[model samples]
Target: MDGLGNYLAPDHRRCDDYFSAAEAAALQGEWEAAEAQFNHFLAGMQHHFAKEETVLFPAFEQSTHLTGGPTEVMRMEHAQMRGLFQDMQQALASRDANAYAGAAETLLILMQQHNLKEEQMLYRMCDQMLVRESAELIARMNAIAQ
Candidate 1:
């Protein structure tokens, strides 16, 4: 958790684990567990996105002075994922497993792609460019309201 990738990548996995648990519970017809797990997953995702959008991305943009670059793309992708989150939430509320499955599938794919870009490119750039500010940046990100 010392570097951007080190911290953020593990967060991604944590969210994914929650997602998997929710999906498994739904598949097993455990509605209560599914709802609980889905809530945890949703909260984890929103918090992660907030940390990046409010802290990491801003720091990267300011340090590099490249506002219309990776951060912009990531923001767009975040919006897209938020839409899927709504869809999944609606499906869960209605206990519609099929609809949830579809939305979850789309979200899973998007998350995989998004995480790859952040881990492989954006994080590496942040690590190199913001090495001096890494500690402060991570602290700010961690301080974001959950």
Candidate 2:
């Protein structure tokens, strides 16, 4: 489960699928299913974030001694993403279809673009510079995720 080659791409697809499912469910007025799928999507996101934040990002930081790298930006963006997710959760809780749909659309864009950047640039950096230090932990995290 290489980060750039397989793991990250697959994770991107999983997120895409969940977001699609959630959107469809919401469009169909299946509020419960939509809510469930959204929750599941959030959980999946958190899991991947954990691997990056705890293992991959730390590996980069330790190797380069540079804190304000892509990972730092990613983490800050994650906090913003979480705020959006929280709003989505509240919308879901209230069964506000309009709000939920809007938030979901925004989140879909945010996550997709974020994943693209990491896969294209940041993950490549990890592979090039920190692969030896990061390889084992990243693989282990991916394994546990699967």
Candidate 3:
């Protein structure tokens, strides 16, 4: 890949694809399909977050010494997204499509906003500031388990 954005930006789209598939299945009342897709989506997202929190963000922080800047905001947003995941899980477990839809809508909005910021700002920052370490950082990110 080109670098940080090249590796991680596609992941954002992959996760979005999973998220959309799961939501579509859920909205259609296809509980089994929804469960399968949601599980996949959840696992992917958790892995993505771990890669960022453990590998990418730490590298950025060390390189830039800006620990409490964008990374901190991203961590908070990750927490918020995790909470939404919980709500979605509970709604799925209960077979409450309406509840799931509500949560999914909120999640979709949040995710779009969050992904935009990361793609436009954070990943660009990483690409610029960590150019020398890009390959190592990408390898570490790729090594993270889903």
What does the lDDT read for residue 15 in candidate 2?
69
For candidate 2, lDDT tens digit of each residue in 54-77?
777887788788898778999987
Q: Which candidate order results from sorting by TM-score in descending order?
A: 3, 1, 2
Candidate 2, residue 129: the lDDT equals 87
**Global CA lDDT of candidate 2, please?**
0.79
Q: What is residue 84's positional error in candidate 3, in angstroms? A: 0.3
Per-model lDDT: 0.93, 0.79, 0.92
**Looking at model 2, which ten-residue stretch has the lowest summed lDDT?**
1-10
Candidate 2 is scored at a TM of 0.89
Order of all candidates by lDDT, from best down to worst?
Answer: 1, 3, 2
| lDDT (Cα, tens digit) per residue for candidate 1, span 1-146 | 48988988988999999999999888787889999999999999999999999999999999989999989999999999999999988988999999988999999999999999999999999999999989998899888888
Q: Mark the regions of model 2 whose C-alpha exceeds 4 Å error after superposition.
A: 1-5, 142-146
Measured against the true structure, the TM-scores of the candidates, in listed sequence, are: 0.97, 0.89, 0.97
